[model samples]
Target chain A: MSEILERIWEYRQISRVELVELTGLTSGTITNLTHDLIQLGILRENEAISGNVGRRRVMLGFDPRFYRIIGLDIGRTSFEIIVMDLNGTILQSIEREMNGVQGPEAYFQVITPTLTTVKQEIEAAGEKILGLGVGIPGPIHYESGSLLAPPNFPGWKGYPLKQMLEQQFDLVTLIEDDARTSAMAERWYGLGKSVQNLVSITMGTGIGGGVVTNGKIVRGTNGLCGQVGHMTIVLDGKMCDCGNRGCWETVGSIPGILSRWSQGSTLMELQTAIRQGEPEALRCIDETLAYLEAALVNVQNLYDPELILLGGRLFPLLAEHLDQLKPRLQSRLYAFAKDRLRIEPATFGTSQSAVGAAALMLGFLLSEPVRLLSLQDS
Target chain B: MSEILERIWEYRQISRVELVELTGLTSGTITNLTHDLIQLGILRENEAISGNVGRRRVMLGFDPRFYRIIGLDIGRTSFEIIVMDLNGTILQSIEREMNGVQGPEAYFQVITPTLTTVKQEIEAAGEKILGLGVGIPGPIHYESGSLLAPPNFPGWKGYPLKQMLEQQFDLVTLIEDDARTSAMAERWYGLGKSVQNLVSITMGTGIGGGVVTNGKIVRGTNGLCGQVGHMTIVLDGKMCDCGNRGCWETVGSIPGILSRWSQGSTLMELQTAIRQGEPEALRCIDETLAYLEAALVNVQNLYDPELILLGGRLFPLLAEHLDQLKPRLQSRLYAFAKDRLRIEPATFGTSQSAVGAAALMLGFLLSEPVRLLSLQDS
Candidate 1:
């Protein structure tokens, strides 16, 4: 039932024949399933448009007033929260700069105001909140509900995100790596909807990626997958905090870009120069994409996501340079990957992580749990 | 009907209550469904086993006499054939070496003799063959039904794989990369049955990987997934024929080991020395593992499959050194992955690819036709 409903939601709206064609389900099965779904308050009969005089067949769609999931984007400097309805509709969202974060406790200390406002807004609108999802920039012990320290975020180690979210509301909570959440946002509501496999490359002060395989996030063993920034894309390039050298992040991070700017000029100067089509600045960013290409090739050689999305605050600049950058990537990858790979700029921009976190909560509710007797003992 | 039968086969045997409990379906639903499944001739009620003596119950099992799939393991110098029943039970299998594979016509010459022998063997056993599946060592153009220029098997590029098979038998024919096929085989009858996401790493003449993400094989846009061998692991360590320097295969493949050994001594001499506990030869293999460690880190950071299966003809040596090698991987990867990641040897040994190809064919027939359109197109 949920699978059929999901197909409808994914397609936004679907005709009866198309549903059978897409899902490979019998027409009778589709009819029976959709009937039950509509009666359950999950779906509605979407009215036909008044375009041409033809057989006016009504389409099926999710009711916009259905359950909503909360999306949380927790970063070192700030946080953003969003409420997304089940039909991919946004209800209420808030973004704010963080308070003084000293230790892991302060991580929760700051979100109190944002959380209160979001819940109040939803309740005022007379809607039931399904769940809260928090996206953090770190390696989470998916089993233990603990966050490990990520090099990019200095003081966010060991944050009890799941407990705090669950305590705040009588709802199931899910926590995901911020970059993965960003990737998910791209996949669920952005350009990734059409792709079965995609790599969402998030380039901020640090570099990260999320793997979408068969239209699902490729969470690795222990739930730490798609950390492409940490891969050794450059050989002996620079010393990275992750105890490795030539990491893509080491060569192509915000700090690395700023430092290079400082060596001769400044980012502002480079920005101004690039605005006027400066050859040197274009060369530098193009070179950065070369490392980006290597990391992406390593990613391609592994899972082979059909699309590659470039996200983060740097996207505006990255977009301008992509026209120049893509050709380099084309020449570097294998013949098969080069021919099939599609590169696109991120659609959600800075808010992807927040939106993706909410999707995780919804996904958690829909997922079937696995039982590990030994793990339960532990 | 088949889904319920699959559940019965998976559990080996289960009571009505157990089925209800496992499936979370209502008792009435289970009873009705079981009756329908039983009527379908896909399931059977075998003799009962009384665990509690007085509380003996009928044991339901998959009907072993339903149908079968034929699998072919197309290798560089040999071929392995396997006949698997619909319920993933291998009825008969055989392996034979090709004396001479001169050119692209090798498939026509070598395959004829092997198929004739395999047909007689299965006919003698009185079984119904459903389809034929073949696992190629390199890329195959599923649409063209021709082999790609595989690096290892130089003589068999563009061979008409599907047309020849279809001529001899009235059976479904499926084709796949050997690693991908081997990964599917594990998903059906081996270690991957319990895991949703997995990476099967085959370390032999070359290092290859098969990605199982979201409980399905991740065939890339061009069906060239799991090409971990081509990924560069070291910085200019050794040149690869694919025009890349220091590919994972360059440092971790058997030919790579031989190349490194040739610089000091022959691989035979090194193996003999290892048997005699010679320090220098031991150090060389240890260095090879170090290079492998880099590739392992590369694999982990990219997708993070739950379990990493080490397979192929030469993986027995890897098993002996896993205890030592696993620690290096642990120390390098993120804390959560280090504990959650499992490394195991291939269960099917030398015949995994053959078994996997057969499994692919069987799964296609058992599943809804629409899902396997790409497979059917070949």
Candidate 2:
């Protein structure tokens, strides 16, 4: 019963016969499990079929009123929170702007009040929080339960986020890099659901990535696995926050885009011109694509993942240069070898980071017994 | 008794009292298993009292005469074959060279006489050849039972190596990449036994790595997972045999080392001077270390394995660089990660590849139930 519910949690709906086939169980067992799930009010049967078969098959799916997970996206000047059902269906959410957070005391003042306010809003809407998952833009120490280094948000390193949330809310708490969390969101509810080994390339103000290998996010020895943003792309490109020169981010990040366009116009000015279809704005987007092609080619030649998802606020510009990157990658691949490559746009858009955090909690707490057993050992 | 034999395989021997402490089985059960193993001629009791707590003790170990496995390392120019017992003690071995092998069929023709001669030598020396394992320089397709693009063996791609060997000898046969086989040998009989997620970097005319993750060799979808040799190190640098440019092999290979040396002096002249500790030879070695440092650092950064083993023929010239590589790697890794980093020399040297292949075959055909289990889908 739990396995079928979990599978539905992954997707919208699946038929009883399909469930039996997937689990390789007897029809009687499937009937019993589905009966128990429906009785618990966690699921309902949809009496609709879009195809011709032996009979009109009913699809079993989540009821949406069973439970909810609170996803928090902590940021420097803004915060976004979403209330999502166990089925990953977001019901009500809010985004707020923050002036500043100086230290732990300031963080406590901001977080406690915001969380209390959100909880009251949810209670008013007749929903309860199952757990809390937060996505911060930085490297987080999973073991010590502290923030390590967040380049975008200063004065936030090594904070006791897990404890702070645990004290205020009686729920499971998790804090991770925003990129990894967003990648998780894509894996569970987006294009990466079928991909086992994938690289979620998040390009925004500060570029980064989340690496998933063997069906789990690879946490580096220092929680730094997907710091490919810091990996040197050009020998002497530009200065980066990691005290390195020629980092990929220096060439592919939003700041990099602005830097390339700074010769004639800034992003603020380019956006105005791009809206009018100016040649200078078009040239800036094109050159950024060329630089991205070189960096992406290196990643492609190394990991060879099944999919590469483009997300964040900046992906709309990707279509401008994707046509050029494809042929460059194909030209470099082995001859006679079939390359199973795919590139997709993130469906969640800017809200991906928050949803990803929610998915992480769901995946961690609601995984099947077999997967839960292995997660503990790993 | 099987537990006792496994312990002996690790620490050579343990008294009956120690066996009880290790296995945690009842004294009566231990007595029965030990007696059964002795009757089966797989174990022998040594009448000695070397390792005892208070009372006299009898040590138990493998009966070396029980069986043997024949291992062959077939390189581009030479071949080294050995007959070693299950205890990993070599009985008789032979090394020979063959300059040319036109193709797989012609390659077999050149090695046939040597194979027949070695078979007779094993039986005459009273060592039964229980199985045969061969390590070649190539990508082996385990599912297809063929050699996939063997780097050094030209015209041998997609050849059914395991099937051909099995048809000839009527014994269990296994074939693996030389580097990966060496990694297996290291993981089983050398430095990587107690370690998980260790990599064996084979440095020679080319640089390749075998990644052992979560206690298994991660053979990517097409049996081409650890192509570290082809990892792009320099963008738009030298071309590699795999039809790619700027590969790590282009800069870190033996020919690269010699060419880097030849800029100032001939490689032979530098080798003679290195014997005399000349400054020019030392400088060339330093340059070679720099190239190696880039490759090893990137690999360590990516996987964060417990240890990195440097093997292959060129390691003798490259061993001194470990001191330089360790600090660079450590500075980039986590502080709490104890025993998670180290650089070790391959104790088995060139013979490890062949021994590893034998271990591979033994791992599949041995009495261990899980290894010997038929892979038929249930």
Candidate 3:
């Protein structure tokens, strides 16, 4: 039954016959499940427009207006909160900058008001609120739903973010790594819709990564599987905030790139310098590109992902130079791996992580429909 | 039904009551399934020892003597073949030196005669050969069952090894990466039996690794997920045979270690030197340990495996120094990850990959029982 709902969600509007073929479920089983879902108000049926002058078939899809999910993305420098429908369309959104907000107490002061406003907006719309989903930087203790030594946010380490959110809002809350949340967003509504094996790279002030294999996130034993930023690029070269030296982020991140480009204070400035063909900027970009090429090759060899989605603030600036990186990557990759590997820019812009956070809740709801059903009953 | 068989295989012997509790299958279903399995000669029933003051319960277990598996492990300098029963007990074994053997035709000359003898012996013993399992040295194009530009064996690239074996033996053939095969062997009858998330690293003339996540092998898009050996440890530090510079194997592999040691030409000699407290050997070992420490940290950060099983010829020599390596690893790992990360030596000795190859066929047969049943029918 959940599979049926998932297929409907994926297709937007799927027919009973198509569901039967796709799921390999019996026609009778599909009809019964769809009927129950429709009766429960989770799905709705619509008549398909016919051009053949024959019987029009009915399509089944999610009743997108029925439920809403609150998504929050907490970065080192900023936070964004949003309310979204089942189709992942943002209904309301609010963004704020964090000027060195240090601890949980300071974070709550800024977060509480924004969440309250969004919650009221969602409630006033005559829609149900399913849950709260959060995307936080760094590795998380999945069992405890807490942060684990997030770089540059030492005060946030070990904070029970999920518990705090649930207690404040009295709603079910799910916390995930920000990069993984972005990958989830891609899996649902972006380039990852059809790809099962993929790695989403967040190239920003710091480099981070998320992996999806066999259609599920690769959350390792401690939920630390996607720390691609810390992968060593130059042995004993540069000290990183993570206590490791020569981490890939030390050479490929925005700050890392800006450090080498004497004329740029920001990625935008670096882009401008490169556009003007400044020798210093070109040299810096080339050095960064070489490291990026090596890291991408390592990603291919280690994860063998079918597609690598590049996101975050810095990716677009480097988008034009991707052609230069590809041939280098192809030459280094295994022969069988070279032809199938794909590198592409991500779909969403600034809202990628926030929408992905909402997707975290929506994805859970789709997989375990009974939870939503119980919430509705309550 | 496959789940029931897997549980029985894991437990070695169990009663229907335990099967019901373990598998969550109804008592009636357990009885029917076990009865059918026994009837097919896939399982056998035995009376339990009467330690209690009650009637003895009948236990069900595999009829090991009825079936057999052939395992082959191919390396750059050597190859090994073994025949085993369902219980993983080696019945016959053969080992030979490759002596710079290259290309498919040359390999067939040596492999064919040995396989023919093994096949005749199994036939004479009235044992059914289930399949032929081959464990090759490098990444394979899984879909096509061929090697893809394996380093040092350029002539063997693109060879249809699986098809060639299947045609010659008239038996089911399975091919897997050598490291992964070693992991499979562990998963079935060794330390990995109790571990769900584990990585097995083969530190030999060349380094290799295999990952098992969520209790199954992580075969990425092209069956190249666990190329831990090629992960860069130093940027432009040393040239690697795989066309990469500063790969972990360039520092941590046996040859890589020997290149830095002036007094030793072989690993055994190096081990002897280190044991004798020679300063040069100690320095070389320390250097190798630092690189290994970095590589292991990277593996932990990227894969976050619960346990890392270290195998191959060189690991045992370094086993005594693991105490020295652990503290360094602990300091660099994430706090939540530190306590849970276990580094241990592999269970099998020299025949790890060969036995692992046999277990591959056994694993496939267990998952798809119908295939074995169909073969029985034929």
Candidate 4:
């Protein structure tokens, strides 16, 4: 049944005959499964507008109006709440900025009212709320869905965010690291669909990474496998917030680059200066690029991923320099890895983490529809 | 049948009752499978050495006399061949040193005769040769089992080593990178038996790493993952043979360390000097440890394996300093990973790679007994 749903999701609108062919299910089994799915409001049938006029076959697709997901992205500086459909279409989104220092209580005070408003709107529209997925900016204890010491946001350490959200909203909830959530977004809805092994590097104010191997996120023993930012690039280099010296984050992060450019130069001003080929700006960008290149080479060597998806605020600024990066990496890579590893900009701008949080819920729903049904029944 | 064999391999010897209890297979099924396995000379039944005075149940165990594997380890400086049983016992072993510049043909000249002598001995003892497992030092095209461009050994580039051995010996042969093969040996017979995720770092003439995740080797796209030696530790510090600057291998490897010390000083002399607390030797050792610590921290951050098995020649030299490495790594690691990761020396001494190579074939047989049966039938 999940396979049938996955086929429909892939094709968007596939006929019953095509489903039978693609899934290798008997026509009777397909009919029975489709009927059950339609009853659950998980799938809908529409009349196909075919070129041939013999008969208009019924095509199956997701019933977007029946259920919606609440995706919350709690970033370092701000938090966002978005209502998303199964098709990843955003129904509503709201962003609220906070000072760098805020405790869990203050965060909940802002989040509870916003969540209630979204829940009410969802109920008023006659759409069932599937779940809430929160994307936080640090390591998470996957089983408990609690935050592990997030840098700068020390107040949220060990907070039972998943349990709190589940109890307050009375919905199924999942908490994942923001980088991993972004990876999920890319895997399901963006360029990652074509590849099984991918690494998503999110470079914003701080650097974070998500590793995907064999089409699933690699959550290591403590769910801290993709902490590429802390990887050392320089011997006895700059001290980082993590208490490490010469972390990739020290040189490759947005703030790190800006700080090196000038004391108060904006990213735009630096970009302008780089475009004009100013020596100091070029020198700063070159240093950052060198560090980025080394880190990228290290990533390629360590993971040997087929595709590396670059996302977050810093990637767009570096996208233009990627051509230069390729040749440099090719020289540094293992012989077999040369020319095979691809570096590309990730799809989805600004709302990547929010959509990814929604994707986390959607992925769970698609893979285990019975769980969703059980939750609804309960 | 594989499950039963694996259980027997685990316990060394087990009664039908124990097998049934352990595997959840019915008594009748266990009896039938054991009977068939005995007929095929894969298992042998023996009178139980029982402490309890009841009906003395018979025990089943592997028939070590029936089959053996030819394990060949081809390294940059030398080559070793070993005859290993299903229990990983070294029945026979041989080693030969080579000039570093020896090509594939020259090395094969030495290996073929030694392999033939071992095969003759096994046949004389009425044992069947199961297969050949070769551990080569370089990136390999996994499917074809051919060498990729190995550093310093340019003549071995693109050598079809596996096919050549298969054609020469007329035995089912498997080729794998040396570090990965060492990991296989660890996973099956060493400390890695307790942990599903492991990384084996072989630091000898050069540095290489093998990653095991979820009890399986992570052979990334092109089968070129776990190249940790090439990961940059210093930004533009030293030029490596791989054309990369500041590679971990350039500093952490045996030659890398020796070169940093007095050029004429042997590793033994340096070890002696460090023991005497000479200032220059202490500085060199400290520098080496610092690089090693940084690389290890990077490894822990990247792979996050529960156990990191340190192998190769250089490890024993630095084993005493591991006490110092722990606090340094703890201070550098992400909060969750601190104190959770275990660093231990690998079990196998000089014969590590050879035993690992044989274990590769043993692993294949244990997982897929049908493939071995078909080979015998053919």
Candidate 5:
């Protein structure tokens, strides 16, 4: 049954005959499964495909109006919300600053009404809400939907964000770590579409990573798998807030880069200075690239992914210099790895987190369609 | 069918009634499958279980003498070979020094005759030869049984090792990386017996690593997944033969530790001096531990494995210092990781690579029992 659905999803507007060929399912089983899925409002028949023949053929596709997902990205300094269709197309999206939001209660106060407005707008558009997916920074208790203590966000420790949102919106909710969510977004709708093994990294205030292997995202034992920023790049070099010394983020992150240059320059200023070939800024950026090279080689040796997708605040600046960085990065790796490792800019850009959050929901639905059926009962 | 074989393998001895209950198979199905397996010589019926009352029961178990596997480990300076039964018990074994042997032809000349002698001895003992499993150091094209260019061995690039052995021995050959082979050894019978996710590190002349997730070893995109030793620990600390600066092995490995001193002292001398509290040796060991701490922390953040198994030449020395090293290692990690990470010495010691090579064959047999049927035809 999932084979048929996946075939339809892949082809977008595939006919029954094409789905049968693609899925290698008997025509009768395809007919039966498609009928049942259509009845459940999961799939819909499209307008007739008019061929130069006696009878026109009807196509099948995801019923965009049937189910909607709200993807929420809660990060260190900002939050984003996006309403998307079953096919992962964004219906609406909004980003807001989280500068003054302090505690869980304060965050709830800001998000609850905004969520309510988004829900009303989605309902007004006549799409049934399937679920909400929230992507948070730091370690997450994925099974319990509880955000663990992230050093950057002190107050979010053990918070039942999933329970609160599920109760408030009265919809099933899926919560994931931001890095893993971003990786999923890439796997579903961006550069990682056809690749099975890859690492998606976001280099912003801090570096983070997620791994996808054998076509599934690995969340690790405690959902702490993608903490690439905390990986030690320097041995006893500098103190880190996490109580580590010489972490990759200490030298490669935005604040880490700025700290070398009087500490008050914004990312914009640094980018401009580097573009204008300022020596001081160039030196700092070069040092950061050196650290980046080490971190990337470390990841390359560890995961050996087909591609490494780079995103977040530093992506645009680094993307422009990727050609220069690639060779240097490749040189640091073992000979066998140099032949296969590829580093590229993330395709989704600023929209990655939101799309990734949404992808979390879609991934869940697609991975376990039986769970989707169970959710439909509620 | 694999579930039944796995149950028999796990229990070692079990009655038909117990097998039915354990596997949830119908009693008739259990009887039929066991009968078929026994007829195929894969299973054997043991002596009856004595009972005070009622009819006695015959126990089913693996036929230890039914098949045998040759486990071979080819490292940088030495090689180990062992013939083992289905239960992973070594029947015969040999260890030989590489002694400046270089290139594929030289290594093959030494191994081919040694393998023939081992085969004759096993045949004299009346055991059926199942396959040969070769564990070599460096990047292996696992599917093709080819070894790529390893820095330590310059001449053996793109060598079709698997084809040579398969045709020579006239048996199916399973070739794998040495580090990954040792990791397989750990997963099957060592510290990682119960832990599904683990990173196995071998700190010897150089460093190496292997990752096991969800009870299966991860070979990565190019079979170079666990090159943890080459990860840069110092930004520009030392130049390495692999064309990298400050690789972990540059400062953390056995040779690296000895180089810090007079350069000719052996590992045993360093351990003796450190144990006797010699100041210079203690300093060298401390410096080595610092590098180890950084490397382990980096791996912990990346894989988030439940266990970190330390193996190779430094295993005994480091295992002795684990008590002193644990706290320092934990301090380097994020708080969340600190709570869950465990570092343990690999249990198999010197025999790990050989046993792991054997496990590679057993693992393949167990993972896909249907494949065993195809092998029977050949």
Candidate 6:
């Protein structure tokens, strides 16, 4: 039954026969499952006329308006909140500058009202919000949904973000690392829709990565699996704030790129400088691209992901320069075999984090429809 | 049914009540499955008297003599072959020196007669040989079971090893990269048995790795996952033969350690020097260890495996120095959390490769018991 729903959710408008072909389920089982789902209001069928003769075939799709999910992307510089329907279509999205947001108390102060506002607005239409999913920076204690001491987020250690949000919102809350959420979101709705095994590298103020294998997120033994940014790239080259020297993020992140020119310069300024073809800016970008290329190659060798996604703030800037970057990455690959990497910029931009956060709920809902039913019952 | 068999295999000996608790299957289902398996000679129930010895409880176990698998480990300097029962108990084991063996033809010359001799000895016992699992050192086209060009093994590129073995032996053949097989062996029958999520590193003539996630081997999109040796450790430090600069294998492998002192010196000679506290030898080992420490840390950050198994020849040599090496690795880890790494030497020693190869067949058999039924039918 969950398989049929997943097929419907993935296809958006799949027929019973299509589900049968896709799932290898007997037509009788499809008929029964779809009937039950339709009756439950989770799925709906519509008649579509084909050709001038108007031959109608029934198509199944998720009842988007029946359920909604809230996605919150909490970043160091800014935060984004989005309400998405079951189909992952954003019904409402708002981004706010969070430069001055200090501690968990300050974060709660800002987010509480925003949550109330979004919930009220959605409730006004009599739509149901099943859950909230949040993307937080740093290592997450996934089992407990607590934020670890993210280097950038100074005061957010051991904070039970999920528990706090769940108590306030009276709904199921799922929290994950921002990079992993981004990867999940991409896998479901963005550039990585078709690929099952892939790595999503978010290169921004700091580098973070997420991996998806066998169509599921590769959460490690401690939810610290995708911390590729901290991997040593240059031995004893530069001391990183994470108490390591020559970390990948130190040389490959947006700040890492900016550090090559002026440490204090904003990414916008760096982008403008590169756009003007400033030699210093170009050299900095090239050097950073080299590090990025090397890291991607390392990721490829380690995971052999089908695709490597470049995400976060720096990717839009690097998009134009990707042609220059691709050859440098390919040149470093293992010589015996033909390279099978498909490197691409993420389909979504800055708002990707928010969408991905929302995808956490959607991923759960898609994967565990029985749990969704229990939640609906509760 | 397969789940029950896997749990039984994993536990070695388990009671029916334990299987019920572990599998969460209904007692009736467990009873039915176990009865079927026992009737098919896949499982055996032995009466064991405990406590007062009046009551006898039937404990389930694999009928070791019911099935047999052959394991072949083809390496650069030597090769090993072993025939083992389903319990991974070696019935017959042989190791051969291949100082001048060149190409697949030469490999066949050495292996063919040995295989025939082993087969006759096993068949004389009136047992069935299920399949052959061969582990060759190189990148492999896992689907075709063909060995790719390995730097150590010349003239082995695109060799149809699995086909050749299958046609010659008249048995099913499974071939995998040596490192991956070693990992599989460790996971099933060695130190890694308890942990599902782990990475096995083979650091000998060349470095290679295998990852097990969610209790299954992580074969990448092209089965090129765990080629950690090829990943660049140094940025433009030393040009590698694989057309890359400063690969992990180039700087951290056995040859890499030797090259730091005198390239011609054998590991045996280096061991002697290190024991005598020779400064040059100590420095070489220390330098190579530092590089190794960085790479392992990188692996941990990337894969977040529960344990990292150090295999191949050099690890046993490095075992005594592990206490010295552990701190260096731990210091570089993420600062927020206490590092939870369990690095250990592989249990099976030099013959681990052959054992791991046999595990490849066991893994397949364990995973797909229904397939075994089809094979039996055939």
lDDT of 6 by residue, B1-378 (tens): 789889998888889999999999999999999998888777898887766857878899998867789999999889999989878899888999998889989988989999988988787888888888889886887778887667777889889998898789877788988989989988898877788799999989889999999889988887778888878789877877665678899988887888888634788889888899888988988888878888887888888898998978888678878999888777777664436778988778888889999999888888988786567546
- The list of candidate 3 runs beyond 4 A from truth reads A50-54, A259-265, A275-281, A375-378, B49-55, B262-264, B276-280, B376-378
Return whichever of 1 and 5 wins on DockQ.
Answer: 5
Chain B TM-score for the candidates in order: 0.86, 0.83, 0.95, 0.94, 0.91, 0.94
Which is the winner by lDDT between candidate 2 and candidate 6?
Answer: 6
* Candidate 4: tens digits of C-alpha lDDT, residues B109-177: 788888888888888988888999888887888877899887867589999998898788888898999
Question: On residues B121-165, what C-alpha lDDT tens digit does candidate 2 reach at each position?
Answer: 767876556678888876677886887776656778888888888
lDDT score of residue A353 within candidate 6: 81
Clashing pairs in 1: A197-A305, A197-A306, A220-B304
The better candidate by TM-score, 4 or 5, is: 5
Please give the lDDT score at residue B21 for candidate 6.
97
Q: After superposition, how far is residue A93 of candidate 5 from its true place, in Å?
A: 0.9
Candidate 4 similarity to native, TM-score: 0.91
lDDT (10s digit) by residue, model 3, range A1-378: 778888988799888999999999999999998898887767889998756786798999887767788899998778999888777788888889987787878988999988887787777877778888899997888888888888877589889998888778888789999999998988877888899989999988888888898888888888888889888787766878776777888889988888887775988888888999999999998899889888887888788899999989888888989988888778777665688998988887787898889989888877898876686545
RMSD, every candidate, angstroms: 5.4, 5.5, 2.3, 3.3, 2.8, 2.0
Per-residue error (Å), model 4, residue B310: 1.1
**Interface residue Cα RMSD of candidate 1 after superposition:** 2.4
The window of 10 residues in a row where model 3 chain A has the poorest summed lDDT is A369-378
Clash pairs, model 4 backbone:
none
lDDT string, candidate 4, A254-349, tens digits? 888987876346787888889998888999999989999999888988898999888887887898898998898789876556878988887777
TM-score of chain A of 5: 0.93
Q: Is candidate 2 or candidate 6 better by TM-score?
A: 6
Task: Highest TM-score: give the candidate number.
Answer: 6
Judging by DockQ against the true structure, name the best candidate: 6
Candidate 2 has a TM-score of: 0.81
State which candidate, 3 or 5, has the greater TM-score.
Answer: 3
